[model samples]
Target: MGDGRRGSIWSIPEGQGRGSRPAYSRAQITGAAIRIADADGLDAASMRRIAADLGTGAMSLYRYVPSRDDLIELMIDHVLLEADVPERPTGDWRADLTLIAENTRRMWLRHPWLAGLQRPRATFGPNRMRLLEFAFGALDVGFPIDEIFILLDMLNGYVERVVRGEIEWAREMRQSGMTPQRWMTESAPYVRELLGTGRYPMFERIVMDARLPHMSAEEQFRYGLDRVLDCIAAARP
Candidate 1:
């Protein structure tokens, strides 16, 4: 991610050392940029917009942050710190993983813009590395490091996909002024017709007989997590 000369943006100071006194700090610029991204999203968090927020020229921002990509890397690492991973693994591997996954899910939902960022090939920033360490350490089971990495990837991928879908649906609901109840009411006729055709028997049976209302969102999430963990346990050699 860095060419050594420019180095990781974290190594750079927030202020121009040549100056008598640096007014704006890197933390200020990064915080402003994060607010912009949080409010409007990654596309809205440009150098120009961030500069406007900081009351400086966009080009001057380069003195503190190297590039937009670098800024985003900073943002990602910054937010990852919010995840309160356990100080040590709970020793129960499945319990530890479930706690970690739930923490991760809450983090994504907290920063809705994160799902939309065009992240680079992960550069292993400080907090990112901390997260990896926590995940690996939590796997108290005797799996090798390589397989542990794969398990982390699978869990991360699942959370990413699930949270993105959840965010997208919420965004659409807000933009379209359509509540789930309203959507069900509006689409009831079409949905009923489709189901009546018996094209999907199992889906219809579940809708009618499985008592989905009893399954809350958290329950649904845990159900999937438990199944995935079960599979992971089975995969152990």
Candidate 2:
């Protein structure tokens, strides 16, 4: 004997049952939630708001989405459809990883709320599964599975770190009119004073000799990504 409860939204069939067709769909609800989140951040995408956006009662949405957690998972997966990766990885692992990295960055920028999701969940929605296959399969060289996991983590970690910084910087600019160029210009006197002391050799070198700080965000990201890929190349058998 088994209970008739469904554990996950993914497991539940859409509009399941032979009654009159449902008034709204999970896709419609999820899409509305995404649009709200994109415009006003994640917390604004409440069930009530989403329902109002669809011109229905909030209670009616529960019949389709069940719960807020389920809705969030759906939203997360729905945006990943924009990642637009190929059906299969090319044999050139570096090129494949580069494609993944670039697409992932663009996706996160388009959905800055994604950077706010701190906890990792085991939700394997279809788009997520496809991306996981492409990323894991890209590193399907001679490395062991565990090593492949580590390598992918390393690559994703780098991308996440850089993209998070970019997201926050953009937010800061919007909120306070702060940008790298403006900050550099405003802080140049203090930076020069510090450099004049010559006490911090590495700091002075970074100030004087580093091209990274002077480059645009895109240039810096590409340069660092190339270095990371080079490291992966060095580790290869």
Q: Which lDDT values do the candidates have, in the order given?
A: 0.78, 0.88
RMSD of each: 3.0, 2.8
Candidate 2 global CA lDDT score: 0.88
- lDDT string for model 2 (1-237, tens) is 113355778988899755688989989999999999999999999998998999988888877888778888899888888778899989999999999888888988999888888943557899989989998898888888888888888998999999999999999999999999999999999998998898999999888899999998989999999999998888886
Leading candidate by TM-score:
2
TM-score of 1: 0.86
- The 10-residue segment of model 1 with minimum total lDDT is 1-10
TM-score for predicted model 2 compared with the true structure: 0.94
Q: Model 2, residue 230: what's the lDDT?
A: 92
Clashes per candidate, residues 3 or more apart or on different chains:
0, 0
- Give stretches of model 1 more than 4 Å off: 1-7, 11-17, 118-121, 211-214
lDDT string for model 1 (123-192, tens) is: 5677778777778998747889889989888887877777787788789888998765687689888878
